[model samples]
Target: MPAMRFFVFALSLAVTSPLLAEEAKPGSPPPERIVEQKIPPLTPPDHELDLLFAQLKKERNPQAARLIADRITSSLFYSGSATVDMLMGNARKATEEKRFGAALDFLDQITLLAPGYAEGWNARASLHYQMGNFPKAMADTAHVLKLEPRHLGALSGLAAVLSQSGRDQQALAALEAYLDRYPADRDAQKRAIDLMIKLDGQRT
Candidate 1:
């Protein structure tokens, strides 16, 4: 009877010990393994500009394209800094009042404060152009283009600068680039055609 009891106890130990050991084992998987789920990365908020640019490229209607261009311009004007925006406003007022030196000072401060802001360079480029500083205007336009390659204003300004410098072929090429991005601009199309005609006449 003792032997029978011993045998029964051994059988119960053999059956239950492994499960108990496994549960206490270090780094052992639980009875139900939990899989860790991976999270997707968040998209950037600036994708709005990408969507707007895509819409601008696809829209064939001139009036609709103009409206889209206006929106893009408005978006570009926002320097993301209240101080810079205020300086820009002051620069505009100075320009309006023909206070060229004060306007330039404001623009200079804006560029220094926000070197990454393409709008500051663009505004400075326009001011330089108005002041007959073509070289400075051209340099500022180059900075604007580097910061925002798809900037319609910068592309147009680049073309204008090239044309004024008497580089007609280069001017036409720049205009062609502008038209490629925003083909619905009637004025740009006319200007491109005019440049082509002018180039053809010059060749003769």
Candidate 2:
């Protein structure tokens, strides 16, 4: 009986020995230690921007989308050239989502970070138009034109916002200016013709 009991005890030790060895091994790190070693830090225009962009893509709510876009744009500004496309993409996404506030914030960062970027001011102006801030939109558009005289989008955006705000005469002038620069732009030509008719009707 004692021999049998001793045999049983030895069998139990043999069965548990591997687990004990695993627990006692100095070369093997603990689970928590392993996790800490593998974890990475959050950096600008990469991890943080990636997360924000994912949220923007998934969230249908404009406010939530705007918040994430703002965060991404702000964070990405520090990454230099790597961030230019990312910032522009985020701004465009925000605009498409109709999150004007977020788009404006992103554009603001662009102007501060890359002041010479014509698209930045143009995009901000477009955002202002979407937000119904006509005066501010016109101002921004004007700046874009000054920086890049042949910027079709800025001219068209100015015309659109002017027409929306009952400044048909100015809108017509802006459209003409755009047509002068982009004579081959069939869309701009068509828009100019439409604006001229509208202005004539308003005058009559």
lDDT of 2 by residue, 85-157 (tens): 5787899998899887887788898778766666677778878777878778777777766655545576678
Strongest candidate by TM-score: 1
Task: Identify the candidate with maximal lDDT.
Answer: 1
Name the weakest run of 10 consecutive residues (lDDT summed) in model 1: 10-19
Alpha-carbon RMSD of each model? 25.7, 26.4
Tens digits of per-residue lDDT for model 1, 49-105: 788888988999999999998988888887656788799999999999999999999
Evaluated at residue 24, the lDDT of candidate 2 is: 43
Backbone clashes for every candidate come to: 0, 0
**Error in Å for residue 39 of model 2:** 33
**Candidate 1 local lDDT, residue 150:** 74
Global lDDT of each candidate? 0.78, 0.63
